[model samples]
Target: MEAVLYAQERSKETRATLNSLRENGNIPAILYGKNVSNVPISVEKLDFKKQFNEIGKNGIFTIDVDGKRQQAIVRNYEVDPITREIIHIDFLAVNSLSVITADVRIVLVNDAEGVKDGGVLQQSMFDLSVTTNVNRFPDAIEVDVTHLQVGETITVGKIRQQYPFEINHENDEVIASILPPRQEEEISTGEEQEPGIPENLEGREE
Candidate 1:
């Protein structure tokens, strides 16, 4: 929940972030805050890489811009889709206690039992949208499926949490389920294979 600080960009002199930052071996970015004006700046790519690695996408870093530091969060980051190199970035000024809505990953636990018992474990939701104070966001929600038998389902209401936020999904919505495995052999036996392929091949002279 710690917040990062950023430097104010003073001049608009810099253009062509790719070429300038490459020739100078730096990354170009702009910093703006709700309370502060936009400023253009650049930082060493290596240094940015180090900080990003330490904190990951959820991390906050103090960006030094022309010596005047202000509160900021990574609003957006531009990366090369193919090479995934950092290209451009936009920083937004953030307050420490602001409420934010974000997507949190949903993880399923003890799911292999379903597959072992001729049941299929179907995960219908990957990420769940949640609203919470910025500092108290949950990393993920873990659902225990060890006791879930075939035809049983786990819904959003079944998840219990009293910390920092609330789940946005409906109570009746199925997060995951254990369904009876499809009986391919039984289903195939119900249908007769058409005689088209065999009928065509039998008359081929080649």
Candidate 2:
């Protein structure tokens, strides 16, 4: 999806100036790419968040700087660790034929068969790095896990076979997997104790 964001050229980039812009509900950003010179600008915080929600990080959009419009994509952003508020943004100008590298979110579709059988479903990778034409970029990649069974896994190679884009990962990289169900162990005292993997598996991020 494509969106248009309105911004105004920023004349001052001092710390105080940037803080002032943020205080005024604007985010300071820079737009640059290839042959384009870096242009410092500011956009309304609410407007940027709205458009960003519509078009994900990989989605191409247009940035209207004053009266000039340029096709661009969100390259990166900085957020305040304390407030979790976006502080700065980096916009990369691009054309239709431009090839870009981006991280596309991985979405698991449907309930896995193993999960239905009391097995634990674990997603190892939440996103994937890909290089593709700007026009062919995807917001997210959906992996069907409906048929995944216990001890079975979906790998990067399997995903690559379904998508035409170039994935910047090894073919053997595991995306998602189903582990055997938790087993209960009988202690010497004849009490049932939880065993096997913990309910909250290690290395799994929320």
Candidate 3:
């Protein structure tokens, strides 16, 4: 999906200017491209929010700058710890002719057979890193764990057949595992020993 984002060229790169831009509700960002030149830009907070919310991070979108359009991906961003608002963003313009490496959301779906048998389900990886063409990148990778059993593990090699992209990890790498239910053991106490008193040794010396 593509999002319509409008950006402006940053006139200055000083802290004071950045602060004033923030006061005006604009965010500082940079756009890096392999084919296009890297440039510093600023975008309105409300405009960015509207596009971000619709396409989401990691989704390929088009950024329109001065009537020029560039296909890019939201590489990274910084958020305020307290306000949870986006502060800065970094974008990378993708070349449709080359393959790019990216992480795709990995979701474990369906009830595991081992879970009903008192087994605990554990996911080792939350995202699957893969290399694929820009237009071929998937939104997310879903894995079915309905056949997973206790003490059994699902490896990357097992689900490779379900995807077209090349996974950038070892085949034997573990993805998810089902652990047996934890056992409860009763605590056993040893016989208590009598406390030694200092006066007891003095009586023997007398």
Candidate 4:
């Protein structure tokens, strides 16, 4: 889960300089953390994307700037709205003993018994916020719904028993549920009124 990314120090923060870096296939980024000074740098976009795909957001890796390497994690990033390309990135320097807060994607595993019986499956939460050591961070949390029946729900309290990390949510918070067929039909059948011209104006035009 750990890999090294090479970067160069960026001396200028001007718009023109950032644009030039992007044109040269580099992504403008900043590295900072507790007790560490913020350093402006740029990394090769292709290399970054390759490493990012291997190590998810919660994975810890090393960033080599100039000749010095630091252990870091992906803190944040900005993407181009039009091109859907990453434009900027924020890296946080961390150590093995550091406890960081990260969002882990929630994955539903197995087919719910309710779904096999024609019940509609609804997921309320897509991810979970948790605080854990850098080495203990999980890429995603999987919840098994194989036995879930209609009218039943999976809650945060139920998931806590399976993982050791601290989840930053209330125990009673619902994650996923199954609705009965009747309720699903009612929700789908509630149609909105369509807009139409008035009868008096139907025969007239400007």
* Weakest lDDT window of 10 consecutive positions for candidate 3: 197-206
Pairs with backbone N, CA or C atoms under 3 Å apart (clashes), candidate 1: 7-65, 9-39
- In candidate 3, the residue pairs with backbone N, CA or C atoms under 3 Å apart (3 or more residues apart, or in different chains) clash, namely none
Instruction: Give the per-residue lDDT digits (tens) of candidate 1, residues 7-92.
Output: 33435454564576656756677777666777777767777777666655545566666675665556688887997888777876
Question: Looking at model 4, how many pairs of residues clash?
Answer: 0
Give the candidate order by descending lDDT.
Answer: 4, 2, 3, 1
* Candidate 2 residue-wise lDDT, 1-206, digit = tens: 45989999998878999999999999999999999999999999999998888877777778998889999988999999999999999999999889988888999999999999999999999999999999998878999999999999999998797998999999999999999999988658666667876766867888
Q: Write candidate 4's Cα lDDT for 1-206 as tens digits.
A: 45899999999999999999999999999999998899999999999998898988788779999999999999999999999999999999999889999899999999999999989889999999999999999889999999999999999999897998999999999999999886433457567766898667897969
Candidate 2 ranges beyond 4 A from true positions: 188-206
lDDT of each: 0.70, 0.92, 0.86, 0.93
**Candidate 3 residue runs with Cα over 4 Å from true position:** 187-206
What is the RMSD, in Å, between candidate 1 and the native fold over all Cα? 5.4
RMSD of each: 5.4, 11.7, 3.7, 6.9
Q: What lDDT does candidate 2 reach at residue 47?
A: 91
State how far residue 193 of model 3 sits from its true place (Å).
Answer: 10
Residue pairs with colliding backbones in model 2 are: none
Best by lDDT: 4
Between candidates 1 and 4, which one is better according to TM-score? 4
- Reference-based lDDT, residue 4, model 3: 73
